[model samples]
Target: MTIGVNCGHTLHGAGSGAEGLFREAEHTRLVGQALVDLLKEAGIYVADCTIDKADTCQEYLAKVVSFANREDLDWFISIHFNASASHKGKGVEIYTYKGKQYPQAKAICEEMAKLGFENRGVKEGSGLYVIRKTRAKAMLVEVCFCDNQQDVDTYYKIGAARAVSQIIFNSICGQCRQGENEKSPGRVQEKSKEQTTFMEFVGAIARKDWKERRIMLPSVVTAQAIKESAWGTSELACKANALFGIKENGWKGRIYIKEAIEQKPDGSYYKVDDTRWRAYDNWEQSILDHNNYIATRSTDGGRSLRYGAVIGCCDPELVCWYLQRCGYATSITYAESLMKDYVVKYDLTVYDKP
Candidate 1:
């Protein structure tokens, strides 16, 4: 189907937009671009209606509506971040024209709430210019309160643009299909098995400069990369270049966002929220980041504190066991999966040699 996406506000106009932990204009554009990419990838025709420069708000709204109408879009989505004077507001909400709740809008809100935001529910927005003016079934999504620190942290933690894009894509485009024949919206193709071979994975790790940071066994690193990223076929690996499922904390570099399941205190596995992963420029950077993660502590110039037991260990099996004990993943068979299925089956220990 055809859809129109409005990024909301000019870079400098729209009265400076909202400012929380991040500028609303930047976040809106980022999320809007991501949504467009995802829609296109899912085989939907998309028209970008974002106004980068507008003399007036009235002019901006008119141009956006005009474009949507001209394109004869089936739906229009206006992406924006919410703001509050007290900076205490949080959660996700959507706006539809006054009369009734739009299914797509409701669906978007539901998917967004799955990222752990409060579901503020769909509300009437007859007064909203975009909603009122668009000819198609239209909705304005207020992703989260930009003024709230907790909300901002959550937004970044779960992946700012990438996470929001998935929610919107899943809500509108449904599931993604595999082959060349495009399916209807709401049906995504299931992902296939690992695409890269074990030797290729080992070679990738071996080519990296892990000499100084060889605290974690190379074989262990290779196995975890394979298991976690599915041999470079997982969305996080392919899209974001995140090989080890490392969550974004204080990373200042690029980010890749995706939904991740986590184990709770009760040992029940639940899709906790979208995780923001550090996006690398290349696969080698991902490998290096993985190396640094398991090798040292914050005090020792590394990012983690739990993997000390595995650090400096040369045995792949021992490293896997130690990582499992450190709660690297919730799977009860995580260690065994690496040891038996990956390391042993692939003969990954050869890569650990100096």
Candidate 2:
């Protein structure tokens, strides 16, 4: 089956997202990406219909629909998180275009409710832009409320991204692992169960950093620390308590010496030993310094913030997006790696508390 999946909203700005305890735009991307990964693993043809850039909501809706329409899709799914001004919502809901019926839609609600979220059931979404405009059968999933702490807590409890993706996968794949593609890696590779200890340990530090400094989301900091340092096992991280690979262009504090890999303009990589990296007194200091870099570093001789868009941002996806845009990392998939491989897989956004 061919499906078009859209991660709702832009990274930030015009069609950004709803902001409450967490970010709507970001979590949608997390869920959508996970779902896409699952469907593809089952040997299903998939089209990512997400449009991350738009000048207005109309543009966002139109672009996404146009992209999906271009594909000969049998199904189109738009993933989103719920939000209420009163912060009273704590449920899972799905919407189908008026007069349309999808058995999978009801199935997804029932399956998700098994994870402790109230089953809000299926509803009509006639006026929804994506639903009305898309050529294929469409459903919009509001996984849970972003503004409600109880809902967010429940979402993290069951691994929102994976649970939602798996439920959707079961609805479509139905005991069929992969259709005629046995060699395709179909099973979702879960994280090491042993990583829980390290996550809770470093999570406390990142949570403290967010609670005290209000600088960056705890999930982003914690994910960076985990991915970059191999859960605090890297020699540089152990010896100096540093996690970020931020170079030492102008440093006055202690430095950690290590071999650094650099990518040349011609897309070639070379290793250079004796490279200096900023070191800290502890992991807390390491996180603090990283946040300091995001807040303080500038290119116009300190006249303006180089990564001003990321300051105080709660959306890990948008934060990473802005950081990558501002030349924070060399990989073109920097935001993708941080979101899919770290934040969503580990359910780290639970740390993005109020």
TM-score of each: 0.51, 0.52
Q: Which lDDT tens digits does candidate 2 get at residues 1-37?
A: 6889888888778888789788888778767766765
Candidate 1: where are CA atoms >4 Å away? 176-354
Candidate number achieving the greatest TM-score relative to the actual structure: 2
Model 1 local distance difference test score: 0.73
Clashing pairs in 1: 173-186, 174-186, 175-186, 175-187, 175-188, 176-188, 176-189, 177-189
TM-score of 2: 0.52
Local distance difference test scores for all models? 0.73, 0.77
Supply the TM-score for candidate 1: 0.51
Residue 55 Cα positional deviation in candidate 2, in Å, after optimal superposition: 0.8
Candidate number with greatest lDDT: 2
Which pairs in model 2 have colliding backbones? Answer: none
